[model samples]
Target: MKQVLISLLLIIALHTTAQQKTENVIVITLDGFRWQEVFGGADSILINHDKFTEDKKGLQEKFWAATTDERRKKLLPFFWNTIAQQGQLYGNRWHNNFVNNANPYWFSYPGYNEIFTGIPDTAVNSNDKRWNKNENVLEFINKQKGFENKVVAFTSWDVFPWILHEERSKVYVNSAFERIGFQSPTFNLLNEMQMTAPRFLGDGVRPDLLTFYIAKEYLKTYKPRVLYIGFDETDDFAHGGKYDMYLHSAYMVDQLIADLWGWLQIDPHYKNKTTILITTDHGRGDAKKEQWTSHGAKIPDAGQIWMAVMGPDTEAKGELKTKGQLYQKQIASTIASFLGFTFKSAKTVAEPVSDMLSK
Candidate 1:
């Protein structure tokens, strides 16, 4: 009996150790998403602004509210109702969660570089499509013992292939209209829909919904240990000054996240063993109409952004209303920490937000 009890304890300890050593990680990015809409909901100030949308009465009726709490819930019900209840939300400037970009350039390439590489580079100045020179944390993780060939990136933006250095990194990358062939009916349906759906941008970019579906299919099929999803409809609409489409895009993406979370809870592989981080490449402007439409060196406060983390491994802190700064660059290391990997990047910029761990 004594020997049996000892063996049982050993088995339990081994299982727990394995669980802690290999946590699945999902990193999601909403391109150029603003922090304003995240916490305060639809900007009551910009909802009906003439530059953003001419349908003033329609906009007011749809998103208007008496308070910030009410408006945010209406705009992003999943974030407010689900994620906030289970995880942590940062970069609510009003609440003192000082989350913002670390790079000087408030654009996609530089911002994404900081996020993946954990370093800010002045050379990464423009949005020109080119392979990044810096090695991202994804590549580093892929080189690790247990994570080799386990990393997958699915992006709606065409530039992601270059941004993450897919060629150099040797990480599996499917961007824009790139879809893997699957015998499943779901994949077939999504591919057919993409064929009929209107192309929102150039370079074979399809609707974000299509991207979401493709990623979902890939998730169930491959079941990668590390997955990165890049959704661009929110930024695309914002750049086009289509406030209605932007709002819809944000809300729909939130639904995708909720659905994924629900599915994860049922999947034995991901249930209670995955850590997901939702954030943006960069932040849009909040000051003026033009700035709101554009993000760059000229726009003040364009570096401000937000991030949310939820999983069994993370603490149930909800929103970080406390006062402190968070850099987008730290995300890579944070992910590494959750997956039982250390970045050890020579071009390191910052340490992981250690409080992010609870597992």
Candidate 2:
């Protein structure tokens, strides 16, 4: 009788451990968004600089405060107010909590490849439009029992199709100016606006707002188990030396995330069962101040990045201050762990960040 009771208790504990709260996962990326801005808010050197900021008084009034805490809240209200309260934020170097890219090249294609493939392939060194040979975690997740045909990506940059290898991976990718094929009033209006809208970033890239609305509508309609949203305005604006627009775009991205999270909480399929992971492809420079507009192998501190996670399965540790190191490559396995799977590939994949997972 004693042996039977112990066996029963052990079985129950195993069953409970197998059941994770995260049923759906959403991954978001902000291209070239620096950890400096993410942790410390608006930069004092760039905010009022005559070369970078156009409307110094207006920008300062909107994003500036005496304290870093207040300034970050003003710039990214949802991140500081919501994620900080409910999730974990990493990569504040001030506290020695660091997140960096495993890849040597601190650019878009290589950084993104490291993020999703979990392999910092030094061979993936260029931003040229070419199919990625590596197997991404998204494709692996799509092949899972319950996630088949339920993985999709919506991106503002056109290069994502090649980066994600949409053709080979069979993952549904709606990027750049591509029109939504869905037949509905909402999708129709979105298609029209996206097609006819002025191409501020050129013909290959659309505004992040359009990408958000389209992805949000798809989330409501198709209800993908795994969805990825890649916003590009921060990188583009910074490269153009438009600090005001960069700050505004970052603020808009935060608002969009808040809107999406609000909707997810009320929806029956996603409420309390969905996890959102947010990070950046790469970091920009800050040592010379002028180098903040560019990132690559030549730029110092470009490999530093940050990550935030919020979900039922993740503990509410808030902003992480303890000394630790995380890499962009770990994100692939981390996303898979949330969904109760371990990401694997022909290449050696990095291990997941165990600290982010619940005990």
Candidate 3:
């Protein structure tokens, strides 16, 4: 009788441990967005510097606040008001809670590879259009039971198809100005608009706003279980030395995310069953304010990054103030863990972030 009772209790505990509440996961990336802005909001020096801000008065009116908390809320209301209230935010250097890229090359390709592959291969050191051989967690999830044909990625950057190796992975990737193949009315309208949209960044990249709309429409149409949205305007504007535009893009992206989250809560398929994980590919330099426009192996501080997660499976710890270090490589596994899978690859993958998971 004693042995049977112990056996029954063990089975019940195992069953409970295997169960998860998150049935869907959405991963969002803001390319090269800095932790400084994410945590401290608009920099007093940069906001007013003649070299950086073309309309100091206007930017001040928009993002300026007396305190860091107020400034951050002004800049990213969704993050500060929603995620910070109901999620876990990491990588506030002010609080000594650090999140850094494991990859040595602190640029786009390597940073993204580290994020999705769970391994920061030294060879992935360029932003060129080269096919990635690493198996990313997205493809891994797509191959899982019930997730087949339910994983998709929409990116503002043209190189994401190569970064994700859509050819080999078979993950649906719609990037840059590529027209959506779907024939729905929404997709058709988006396709027509994209064809005529100004390529302000260049011919190779579409605006982040377009990318957000495309991804949002895809979600409404197909309801992919795993979705990735990569926004590129922040990085592009910063590189062009347009500080005002960079901040504006950041604020716009925050609003877009808030809109998506609000929609998710109302949809029966996604309500209370979806997890949203947000982070940046890499950080920009801060020691020299000018270096804020760039990120690479040369800039040591560019390796610093940040992450935020809110969902049924994540704890609502808000902004983490405790001192702890996390790596970008852990993101792939952390994403998979939400859906009750351990992401594995040919190379050893970093373990999931235990702190973010529910107890």
For residues 74-141, could you state the per-residue lDDT of candidate 3 as single tens digits? 99999999999999999999999999999998999999999999998999989899999999999999
Please provide, for model 1 over 1-359, each residue's C-alpha lDDT reduced to its tens digit, 9 standing for 90 to 100.
99999999999967755767337999998888789998988886678677777787876777778999998888889899988998899999987888888889999989999999989789999988888999898898889887788898888888888988999899988888765666788888877886777785775466788888888888998788899999998888888887777887888888899899899889998988898999998888763556777888788878999999988777889989899999998998898888766787667557898777765
Per-model TM against the reference: 0.91, 0.96, 0.96
Q: What is the lDDT of residue 122 in candidate 1?
A: 92
Report the C-alpha displacement of residue 125, candidate 1, in angstroms.
1.0
1 or 2, greater by lDDT: 2
Predict model 2's lDDT versus the native: 0.94
Candidate 2 residues lying further than 4 Å off, grouped into runs, are: 1-17
State candidate 1's TM-score: 0.91
TM-score of predicted model 2?
A: 0.96
Misplaced by over 4 Å in model 3 are 1-14, 17-19
Model 1: how far residue 115 lies from native, Å: 0.6
Task: Report the poorest 10 consecutive residues by lDDT, candidate 3.
Answer: 285-294
The C-alpha RMSD of each candidate to the native structure, in angstroms, is 4.7, 2.5, 1.9
